[model samples]
Target: MKKAKITAYVDAALFDEIDALAARRRVPKTQIIEAALASFLSPDSAEQSEAAIVRRLDRLTRSLERLERDQEITTEALALFVRFWLTTTPPLPDDTYLAAKAKGKERYGGFVETLARRLGKGTTLMKELPLDLPGSTDPR
Candidate 1:
């Protein structure tokens, strides 16, 4: 195919980038410029670009939704635990308070160790529970 020559002015920085890209690809500067121009002038370029953006946005939306669901689960779990603890735990007498505190600290350490081991083993409560719980049909 025959090619025509044309001259146009561009920013020095832009020209430098083109030069670098052409050198890196081991292609002629004219080839790089021609490919760029072809891409820019293609009728479907905008549509293709928009479609790619929409795909990315869709993926991001799904990710955000998952994060939101996880947050809700975490909040619900915490709230339920707090409510249960408040209702079930009896206030300790003054004489036994210090002993209870010491025992609580020891229990907490054991809990941490158990949690670390569970996490290391990649075992999660979420994995144990069914996504569709019995007696619950609500979908969020």
Candidate 2:
């Protein structure tokens, strides 16, 4: 191909970078400059960039949707469990309340220890449940 020569001023750092890229790509610095100019002048360059940005936005939207779904599930589960617990638990009689409070504290500490142990061992009830259970659909 016939090529026309042109002269332009460039910063020393940018020149060095172009020189490095040319060396890495096994091409002349002029070729590198020409390719860069071609890309910069091409009308499709902006469209290609916009397409990339759109793809990124789509990924972000999907991620946000998954996050929102997980949050909803957590909120519903917590509300239902709290409601069930409030309904099922009986109020302690005044005379035995102090002793019962102490026992409850001890049980809570034991529960925390057990929970920590299970978490440390990576054991969870969700993991034990079969994926093929009846009427179960993956939220994902």
Candidate 3:
């Protein structure tokens, strides 16, 4: 195929960039300029770019939704635990207060250890929850 020659003016910095890129790739500067012009003038370039951006946005939206759902689950679990603890636990008498505090500390340490082990094993309350649980929006 025969090629046509045309003169065009570009920014000095852009010219330098094209020169550098051509040198690095061991190709003629005209080749790089031709490829860049072809891409810019392609009919479907804008649509292809927009489609790629939309795909990324869709992925981000799904990730954000999952984060929101996880946050809701965590908040609900904490609220339920607090309500149950407040209603069921009786106030300790002054006579047994010190003993109860010591026992509570020991039990808390055991609970922490058990929690660590479960986490290390990748076990989670979310995994144990039924898919059909009330108020759950999880599709899995």
Q: Candidate 2 on 64-119: residue-level lDDT in tens?
A: 98778767766887899999999999998999999999999999999999999999
The TM-score that candidate 2 achieves is 0.70
How accurate locally is residue 34 in candidate 2, as Cα lDDT from 0 to 100?
Answer: 89
Encode model 1's per-residue lDDT on 2-43: one tens digit a residue: 999999999999999999999999999999999999999998
Candidate 2: C-alpha lDDT:
0.87
Off by over 4 Å in 1: 1-36, 135-140
Clashes of each: 0, 0, 0
Predictions in order: lDDT: 0.90, 0.87, 0.91
Where does candidate 3 have its weakest 10-residue lDDT segment? 130-139
Clashing residue pairs in candidate 3 are none
lDDT of 2 at 8: 99
The CA lDDT at 126 in model 1 is 62
Tens digits of per-residue lDDT, candidate 3, 101-122, equal: 9999999999999999999999
Candidate ranking (lDDT, best to worst): 3, 1, 2
lDDT of 3: 0.91
Screening candidate 1 with a backbone cut-off below 3 angstroms (N, C-alpha, C), the clashing residue pairs are none
Per-model TM-score on C-alpha atoms: 0.68, 0.70, 0.69
